[model samples]
Target: MCCAHKNENRGAFIVLEGTDRSGKTLQCQKIYDYLISIGRKCIKTEFPNRSTDVGKLLDGYLRKTIKLAPEVSHLLFTANRWELNDYIEKNLQNGVDVVCDRYSFSGIAYSSGAINLDYEWCKSKEQGLVSPDLVIFLDINLSLSSSRSGFGDEIYENIKDQNNVYEVYQSFSNYSFWNNIDASQDPDVSLKNC
Candidate 1:
């Protein structure tokens, strides 16, 4: 059994979330490397992990070669997270900082964007999973983000889809523990704030 009270120095779980081209990937890497440089044990990972079976399905869905219902895709995304829950929990327990590029919030935003599902329905599936100690949201202007990195062939990479997801993210802004950071500045400045 896991002890409720453990060492005070247990590592923190940090999640970085943002729209595409919002610099979240770079920020996640920077944070992970910084933690390592400080002698903290850390592991960085991303959602739609693309390594597991469920992730493979998600990859296919994103690729558009295989069609899945919006709800089904949402469940798959949730299940992918479920697969990593234990690993994340154990790592934190062992004093390892787990840095995630994207997480449940991304799932909620992206899935809810694709389908008009209840926010409750989207959030309910993640209720008991370990929550991040910190969630840094790299908020970037939609047009700027899209301009930096043009839309890809992925299912949710278009302007319309991104707009919807952005709204969804805004809707849940109050319910979760998140820090919204303006990502329009230099990466160094962004990292300093985050």
Candidate 2:
């Protein structure tokens, strides 16, 4: 992982990462809500934000409307993160906690796992991006995740690709700030553990 420039007074930057149907979106909202309920200043955001121009291309790629080579797609994903780095930095510097649905790790995981790209090269793309204070990875077996609602809706939602993605996520288990949660558990249980 790249060393990020952290501010002592900044709010925590937490990111949720997982394979398809792994409940990252739901967890991100729940985390944000919980933080707010406790009177914490928090905001929710997501990667491949699907709002900026680069993100629009990413959205198209995810939705199967646009096709890109693995290398190009990987760079685009990183560019999308770069597009929002200032926003994340600003909120954090202002002491607003950020609960982001995805981030650079997902970029590396998806690109390297699904497309067999070089892992180190994929990681290099994220070199200067802001690193999260915590990375909550919702871990679930491929069989279980594949059975979840809306499975296979996206291009990389196949069992084979997800299995590869799962392995890639597993490889991140050693990161000091990474936490693995059993996503197969009940939402409340997962949330409480988090």
lDDT of 2 by residue, 10-54 (tens): 888999999988899999999989899999999999988998999
Best by lDDT: 2
Residues 36-116 of candidate 1: C-alpha lDDT, one tens digit per residue: 999999999899899999999999998988999878888999999999999988889899999999999899988777567
Global lDDT scores for all candidate models: 0.84, 0.89
Query: Scored by Cα lDDT, where does model 2 land?
Result: 0.89
Off by over 4 Å in 2: 2-6
Which 10-residue window in model 2 sums to the lowest lDDT?
1-10
Clashes of 1: 0
